[model samples]
Target chain A: MIENELRPKVNEFEIQGTNFSDYQSPLFIAWQLNSICNLECLHCCEEAGEIMPNELNREEVMDFCQQIVDLNIPYVAISGGEPMMHPDFFKICEFFRSNGISLKVETNGLFINKEVAARFGKLGFRSVQISVDGASQDTFEKMRIKGNFKKVIEACKFLVEAGVNTEIVFVPTKFNIHETGKLIDMSYDMGIYGFYTGKIMQIGRAGQNWDILCPSAQEYEEFFKVLTEKEKQYAGKMKVYYYPYDVIEELKYRLEKPSASLLVIPNGKTKLIGPLPFVCGDLRKSKLSEIWNDYQKAWKKDEVISFTKQVIENPELLKEANKWREL
Target chain B: MEFQKHVKVRQEKFGAVVFETLREKIFVTNESGAQILSLLQAGKEPEAVTNELSSMYDGDPAVIKKDVDEVISTLQESGIIKN
Candidate 1:
């Protein structure tokens, strides 16, 4: 059904009255194929690398994909645990592509090899975002924990060579902030399309060791200045973006707000916002209009206001916001 | 009069409800409850809130007063609505 047909009609009593055009629905849907990943990063939000069995099965995922296609979402981002870890990762990609939904896979770049990269390219995937937290093995391995930096680099090469749009996301912590430039240069050399440098948000397991994971405002400013300067130097070659709410203003002009995006968790909970526990609505039961209406109401009631305000006030928080774009 | 901490009314698409995420609980209330919440946000006293609800809805002042008091008391016990 067309979104307009399903759009809820808001009347005067609506908390946010009718003139809510500025609010856009999610254009890209991020489906967490599985929460299990090969690498356990220090600041992993989805807590990937930890297997959560009893998640959505293949049939359920297919149904979810059909719903997404019905909704006419332009893009679907397959994330994890590690999407590759799912038994039907290839089938999932094929299903999404066959249904005319552009797929973007978020991975650690370990399982993605030359063959897999070529297959994804052949299947017409839109982009592949791989987290390369460090430029060197020492720092990269530290953040990714179980990830093989060499394998990640190899995956990058394969994806680039296969003509896949590759985006390298660097989650800067005290240990890897210094390697930001090197990471960018390395990613650019690998012929990647963009580099997203982000600060480690003190959420999830990363919150425990926040003293080391979270960067100070001053540190972020220095890192951002250096990175953006490099980004300018490499302008035509690759686009670079930064994260954390603090640096949004600096990168605001370059950000493109897509038309509609939605994130469906394994449990059938579809979220318009970030990967928070509060879902907009469950697609298994609620209609798209119901979800959109709920999201609008929540957004109006300041549920998302604090997070948006935090991003506005602190550019560093933009990093998380940027991550959502890829998701 | 004993007052509790701040109370916030989060109006979602399903309906206007009060919830505390930190506590991970939802407090469901009706339109009158939402009206009472609006008045409380303005720092209105129980009597004023009763008066406002009485005026807004087709209810008696005494009944409104008792209902508002009950809602406020429950909200207070739940640590959402405060004085």
Candidate 2:
């Protein structure tokens, strides 16, 4: 029998609308819990290691979570420099879980012990995605500077043993590209439920290391060929999801359709995703629903469209606009 | 006899989408299966579901009963229904 905890939250929204695409509410929130990270990885997108001064307080974070509950958002994906490092991480997770909001977490996995993994299982989180950048300890330590490869491996085991649905998130860099197949094998061996990997985005600390870390076009092609074969091999056994980065296609997609998910930073501000740096509204200053609607509408603005066009035509414009600038 | 608390059926034009919320599983049923599921969700007994389906469709009563029983058994196996 499928356990009660295995059921997904029935989205009334899916039934009410004739077409799923026509429905406008943000399907989920990518809430960055804190800026504090325990690792200083070579490709750290947020360069996250220390907490920002303006990080949201527990009360504010709880209020924002309550707002999400009120808005009836069924799912949330929490991440951070490392989300588990958040002072009120469990409290925030409990709020969402108790409200019947399904959750997925993106973490560095250094903090997950047996007790923590069991708690995650008991809370019934949808899945926990732990970053595992390399297949071997040497490459892992090289990419995830200051990260303990053995500790993370142990964490994955603990999560799996605790009955928590654990997954791996890999950012294919020069150091880890060759190990993609090996890592997937390792993840499957660990009893991971899914494997999510993608081309390392050239932003933040990664942008600084792009020349050295970014995989060559030929290397990416070779890696993807291996990935396709692995997908078939793991078809029924484990789920494999990857995002092959294409700058032009991604920019055009963003121009035509905004993300169906809101990106809430550690400071409670709803920022647009990378490339078109726009802050729609602050959750602390406005209702989440209002901010979400405004964000959707912001996609069609003349300035936003024009900026996106210029960037699409001349990708270098992205470098200047990538910072969190008010639109 | 009825859907478990976690099972939710959302009617679609073609049929219905049954969400087993706990395990996050989804079952897409055809029109007849949707009717059977809805009847079962409305607290109908297996025999009553067969009768209701028989009245609505042109299938033979005996075949309808067998189909209903099959659907019920499948739902039970999937943990969507409880006795």
Candidate 3:
């Protein structure tokens, strides 16, 4: 028998004079391999293209992957500016696969071709998330800005056909909120394993264009209700995971409690929360444990619970809750 | 957050080096550049530093002024330099 293949390493380190723990059990690591992307999406959080030649090089990424393997992290998501745009992307995947790490990749779906999808399937990646903001070419192209919507759909088809555990990530916006249900149906028709929705955060390009980017809380909740009903109708075939705000009380039973997750930027700077301001520390200089502990302290349980409750009860509070990272 | 236009030292695996944060981009510099940055941090204007740098390094004042101006513009764009 494979003796409990997943085991987390418990190590401590310090960051900016604060102590923390690293890679606690049940936690996931999000490694941002590069801040360079093939297509510059309209609402990119990283403002990716601005920073070229990100600090963490190929060797550094391999070493970091090895450390996660040593720690036996249950899962790790390779994200980007556009992870596929990384010169050593395949090598990184091969390293993770050899280490028995459950891997997930978040991509724009523009760069992924049939050959790449097949390779990912061969590597046994647990999941691949492709973002499709709109249902039709006109809507999708407007937001995605570069690639054709048909190309993205083609990529999705490739992943689904390749027997990959595929997810369609739809970002609800004023432009695409109305098409949420259609997008889900499209995802289902394409043989997608699941669909997940993300609420746009007001940061980076989105922040700059808040007038057009930020959707009202009511609009989001309405869309959520529609999607939830659709999910019920198509229950056995495909799974749908809503964003934090859209999740209802009844769905909470199915919702997994938020676990500790770490996001390391391309420069090796690590942050406990999702993309936002302030990094805990640079992983190369500080031990992972130290950064984790300091992050835990920052993430006050009482505060998070209270804020979460408020958001569920009053959708208007979603904006405030999304900024949990900054707090 | 707001950052001031100045040279900050970042220690990398290679060695301790200075980078001028112009907006968010980190631009590395040599000893002479560092000295000029220090002078700027000390509230010296480009014009004021021209004579001093010319006497110290035996370089042309016009060249020094041109270089300082270019760096300052980049720093301003990067949010490292404020009026």
Give each model a TM-score.
0.65, 0.79, 0.65
**Chain B alone: TM-score in each candidate?**
0.77, 0.91, 0.65
Off by over 4 Å in 2: A1-21, A320-322, B1-83
**Residues A1-327 of candidate 1: C-alpha lDDT, one tens digit per residue:** 112322122112221112232323334466777777667788886655666656766677777777666655545678877888789888878887787665778888888888988997788666788988888999988877877989899998999889887888888888888888888888878898888866665445575566778777788888989887987989777888765453343223212221234567666666544423345677667766566566556544454555655655664453453133211
By TM-score, how accurate is candidate 2?
A: 0.79
Docking class of 3: incorrect
Candidate 3 lDDT tens digits, A260-323: 5577888887754442243556767766666666556644555544554554566444333213
| Native interface contacts retained, candidate 3 | 0.00
What does DockQ come to for candidate 2? 0.12
Per-residue error for A293 in candidate 3, Å, reads 3.4
* Interface root-mean-square deviation, candidate 1: 15.4
Sort by DockQ, top down from the best: 2, 1, 3
Residue B31 Cα positional deviation in candidate 2, in Å, after optimal superposition: 15
The 10-residue segment of model 1 chain A with minimum total lDDT is A7-16
lDDT of 2 by residue, A100-216 (tens): 777889999999999999999899888898999998899999999899999999999999999888889999888989999999999999999999887776667787777899899
